[model samples]
Target: MSLLTRLLERNLRNSGAGARRLYSNHAEEESSATKHEFADEEPVQPPRHQKMATDQDWSAVWPGPRTFQPSVVPLPLRQGYTEKGAPPPSKFANAELMKIPNFLHLTPPAIRQQCEALKKFCTPWPKGLETLENCEKRFPIEIKSTDYCHALPTIRNPEARRVTLNIKLSDLKFDAHAKDKFLRLVGDRYNPNTGILTIVADRCPLRKQNYDYAMYLLTACYHESFVTESWESSKSEADMEYYSFERNKSKQSAEAIINWGQPVEEAKKLNADHGFAQSVEQLINEGENVYNLGKYKEEVLKLLNISK
Candidate 1:
């Protein structure tokens, strides 16, 4: 071989060896970098509930209202419906559990603690208003309203705006004419059995407004009841709401039969038969029911001194 060709071959061999060495070093560096990256990475942690102690204060952990967290709660709660054979969905990553309200903070012990804390701000009951009867006497008017909490965009409930006012008719001082007029004005709103006049007001949008409206209605009815119209005086016995024996022709007939051929003073005394008057009034007013009719028959026989 020529000297120049030999020299070129030797140089090519040296370059090939250097290239192999550089490639080996680069591969070793890449492998070491990959190993270091893996060593620096953190391991995945277990759930928070697994780390929590069994006797831990749950109220402190879940203080106040919040969306449910599966990892934070210790209980194995499950929700959401599944197929007939399948079990309900687990608490982990459950949309059903997260969507609804959680009462975790309102545990019995927590409630007792809260109530104790609030006791200092409360006032003792008034001395005379201990009994329900005394309370009703002291506060004749009873106002009722409702409050609601919902997971809705708007907190205002339409039904909550309605206000109800209840008061016994007897609580108000009313004469015969005024009482009758008040009953007529209230119609069926006044329960005869309970004697409770219920005034429900929902015409206004706000609760306060509805409450004011109900009070206004009650006051208006009360004042209007005492006002005697000219037409009311003209109401004859036949036009009376209830039968009154004294105001009916039956009174005169009974007096005539009882005091036949007697003097005026004797007739007046004989006319004062309370049993006969009561029987007549009841039979007419109560629509002649079997019991009332029997009572009337007995009273009539007694009044006329006739045997059954």
Candidate 2:
């Protein structure tokens, strides 16, 4: 073979290798540029809360009490403890804040809207139940309720077993003796100021049992109050827990003073003064006070027709 021919072949092979290397470099550059362009054209996802507009209705986002949601809320809130001088972590992806309950769904407008929506399922107010007095007269019994929240496996509150029953003492018909007996039987559960009887029964573990027990207690007291035991009739005025001037020397003395040296008819007329008798009794039992003395003096003057 000729040397020149061999050298030309070597040169041709070297040029081809150089061309391939140049082509490979150009293709790699083109591929890298295409990737950069595609990356620039891709859509950017902004923070979820940033999408919320100022004019957006919060009621639509949350309609009731629920777990806290950070993404949907537009507020720039932060939570979790930090160093003394450091700010708290941002609300986004904040486990400490999200784990707690939120009142976002309980906004005034949301509550109003929820109530309006629920109104369609409610019944109209009953007739003749206009005033609170009228309602109380119709339904004197009041039942109490309670709610509880827990972070346990089961949602049970021990206090939920407690049941309260209240009713006006006036609602139950009773004579003076029966009423006194009922008051004594109920002990401190009866409120003299409000004339209400409050019965609380927590002896049972279940609420229904406790409620039933309270009802039984009330019924038993009412029935037992009317029973006239032989010992009850034998009780004298001195044996009474409280003072009663009616069966004492005070009533007779007061009547005698008001009807002094008068005939039977006049005495009967004077004795018929119930207001005077009541005022005199109250004054005697309650002891001396300016108001009581004034009231007693007024009653005595009215009964005897004396001018001061």
Candidate 3:
């Protein structure tokens, strides 16, 4: 708007115009130089191709899904058990046992309670049972019994003795039990009559019911040891036709030897019941030693004991 200001402004514009024109010319020169350089260079042969002479290595190829190994691995085989304690058969007895007739075995004692009748029948052999007369110890016979009840007082004669049974013989289930009872009773040497039959018949081991007649009959069979008359028969004396006295005596001896081994009187002792015998021998030796040492004048008479 003022004259001097206009004159200063015109001089600034004219000076700035030369600077701007110079910068513009410099930019143009740089672009031209790049263009000329590009034009002078030959275009690159599109890139040299390489034909790979070796196989492509895929050793490092990674698996798509990651997996983990089991902590408890699978096994081709596993472990278990065997039957170790099976029993061996050889040690046991499988023998076919001798069986008795059912009538003889299973019958209630009422049927077999005939000790008196059997004694009556066996009466023909006063020396002993006729059938068993020629044989070893006669097995006491029990026959088909009748239900006759009677009282027999206990006998204490030396030849005849009486003992009570733990269980009644007639009440046994069968001949096996009867035989066991008989053997045990007869086995005693202290006495022959250690068997007793009871009307009490209780304590019968097999069925436990009492057989009064059976008990009495077994008692009578046990009585056979003493009452010779109970077994002695007028008939037996008459029937000497079947057996002779000399023959009977020989038979008795043979039977005794066969059944009881020359009587218990002939059995050898295991050794006289030495009892305190060894203790006395030891005391004597000990006393002798003390005397040899001259320790006492009396010579230890404790074993010899002289004073009254």
Predicted model with the maximum TM-score: 1
User: Candidate 1 on 1-308: residue-level lDDT in tens?
Assistant: 69999999999999999999999999999999999999999999999999999787777888798999999999999988899999889999899889877788899878888899999999997799879999999899999999987767686999999999999999999988899889999999999999899999999999999999999999999999999989988988778899878777888888788888887784355763888888888887778789999998999899888997
TM-score of 3: 0.15
Q: What is the model-wide C-alpha lDDT for candidate 2?
A: 0.83
Q: Which pairs of residues collide in model 1?
A: none
Descending-lDDT candidate ranking: 1, 2, 3
Candidate 2 lDDT, 254-306, residue by residue in tens: 77786787787843545536777677667767888999899988877887789
Worst 10 residues of 1 by lDDT: 263-272
Candidate achieving the largest lDDT: 1
Of models 2 and 3, which has the larger lDDT? 2
Better candidate number, 2 or 3, judged by TM-score: 2
TM-score of 1: 0.77
**Candidate 3, position 131, lDDT:** 67
